[model samples]
Target chain A: MLADQVEKKAPVRRRKEARPQELTTAALSLFVEKGFAATRLDEVAARAGVSKGTLYLYFDSKEALFLAVIREGIVPIIEEGRKLLVAHADDPVRMLREYLFGWWALFGDTELGGVPKLMTSEAQNFPEVAQYYVREVILPGKALMREVLDRGVAKGVFRQTDSELVTHILMAPLLHLALWRHSFAVCCQVPDMDPNAYLESFFDLVLKGLAATPEGGK
Target chain B: MLADQVEKKAPVRRRKEARPQELTTAALSLFVEKGFAATRLDEVAARAGVSKGTLYLYFDSKEALFLAVIREGIVPIIEEGRKLLVAHADDPVRMLREYLFGWWALFGDTELGGVPKLMTSEAQNFPEVAQYYVREVILPGKALMREVLDRGVAKGVFRQTDSELVTHILMAPLLHLALWRHSFAVCCQVPDMDPNAYLESFFDLVLKGLAATPEGGK
Candidate 1:
């Protein structure tokens, strides 16, 4: 019964409906292989073993398909962030560490390749998609982080500054480094950098920034 | 005569050289308009007002042309940064302000609509390009800011820490903000946030990070 629900096949009783997720996964593979702009519904359908009619049943157009792919791709990255940040609830450093590791795991799928390019290239052109990516991924991730930061301030582990801005500062290095890693790792020429320790140093600097001058300390 | 040496097409240049740039720029318009894969060289040549033969005269393939466009687009951003940073040799805060503003200016350009996208997308496929972009543009900008950071540390404007990591930290927010600005501004329904003041607050936080303890305030 659990496996059946999990399978959630286009209920064999009805006109064929492609699973939104399965379509997304298939789209991911095509987008990675051919580049997003070059990918076709037929190609995605063929790869998914569905007809073009079935592919269109799920996504109205290539743009819509790409948007769904991105939304699906990043959702867990945000959701798990919410869960972890809430779970740790007391540890900003630990929360940050989990967030960094989490994003890498989510992006580790090679099929998600075109999504980054999509976010960077076509995002501006399709502001809705860009806005969606930012709203879904960035806003929630930053919000979760801000909550952790606010906790740090309450616990007096962090100095008082506008928590909102501080959150942005804390997150910037890790995300920037990750984005660069995503971009370069494909070419196999990325710097031999470790993402985990980099996050630690990054958090250390954030702590140093929020050290509150230690009363008599600078 | 001095201007002539710099401005004149160098005698060493092959006639084929300039055509590639023209082809790439033409293709960039098509890439931005129709998406990279959707664009054909014939369309690109038409956009550039050259023959199909003319397009082939310069570029061996679409991939080469696309890479050329990416290189051409980002070079100016880097060169402008170099000039701006060089001009503000003495002041780190001032240098940072100029750098952030210059970056926003580049990000706002509609000409290379797909650049950030290409950088991210292609990075997965083209690490060499990503390396070039980071080393040539990002590292140079970091080097410029480092001078100011080192000066600030020496003059008691900042505290002692590894200037390199600090430099990366100082830049993190600006870079993140730039990446998500269009989507973020609209999703959060923000008007363009003032880049200058944002840089000021960002650095103020940074300055606090670098402040020497009263005992260490040598």
Candidate 2:
């Protein structure tokens, strides 16, 4: 009876994640550093410590791999979801502050900064990357902000304004900052080094518009 | 004396505007409709009623010709340069109000609303175009606003602040309007279509920030 009971717990196997999956992760690390155009498959394979053929087993082509990296990398961050409304469910003013801070923190990360500009500058030509960039990154961020704005209106904190247009206005500074960071200021100084403080002024203006007790408001 | 000058000008060798210059003007009408990538040199020559060789006399390459079209075909309106600043130099609040009206009228023309976006997006990779964009287009606009802001602060109608950064914020709404007209609204409808009214809200926010009296501020 003891022998039978001991055998019953045996033969449990934890499946290892596939080698090809590991290769894809390795490819991404190389691509992000050198850029999609400059990165070579051989360099990727070498970096991954895999043969060229083994690398090809995971990604069919460099473009295909680049597309996958953006899709895999950007999607998760945007999908993490925003906490402005949920966290501050009853307070619209606090929620607006939190929302601005949320976007400011996201773009402050240089890794996050590069993706949108890199994708946008190349979007006119590469339809695939453009589609993936918008669907995964832009749409989700818009949705999160839209929810917060809707919450502000419903809470009677913000004016009964057009939520969609206000969402775009709220987004402009961040997107502008991203474009500046990745494109012109890659190794350059931001005019005012602390972007968060600058972004705060923008938030200050927008939130005041949404504020129920707007000072000397129309 | 005027009659004598006219007679002297009429008989002397008249300068011929370059054949390709003439051809480019004709080409622009077609290109605006068909787009640059789709337009052909031969079609441009045909439109100008010139031989392709004659068209080649001024602009040797397609890219050169297209650049010339962008350079010449697009320009600020005559009315745009007739700025009200000189008239209202002593009254900055009036200057700023008048200045904003100028921008509103110019941008509302519909013909010019898309030029800046098209040039920035399409020509960003080209160094010369980007330089021209930064210098001729972006800088002058900023300088004009800066002058107005400086005057406002001096007159105590506006608070003293970083005029350049303040100018950037002032233009943010214009950029937002362009985005809605061109790209952002592609995914969703633009709810607030009245840009002048939108600018009123935006300008009001800025003026409030600069206002000396804060008695009613919450």
Question: Which candidate number maximizes TM-score?
Answer: 1
* Predictions' DockQ, in order: 0.32, 0.09
Worst 10 residues of 2 chain A by lDDT: A184-193
Cα displacement (Å) at residue A102, model 1: 5.2
At residue A214, what lDDT does model 2 achieve?
61
Off by over 4 Å in 2: A1-70, A88-91, A118-136, A153-160, A184-194, A214-218, B1-56, B60-70, B73-101, B104-124, B184-212, B216-218
lDDT of each: 0.65, 0.60
What is candidate 2's CA lDDT for residue A14?
A: 29
Per-residue alpha-carbon lDDT of model 2 for A68-102, expressed as tens digits?
A: 76776667666444643477867767776776676
Error of 1 at A35 (Å): 3.9
Alpha carbon deviation, residue B12, candidate 1 (Å): 29
Tens digit of lDDT per residue, candidate 1, span A119-145?
Answer: 655554567877777767767767777
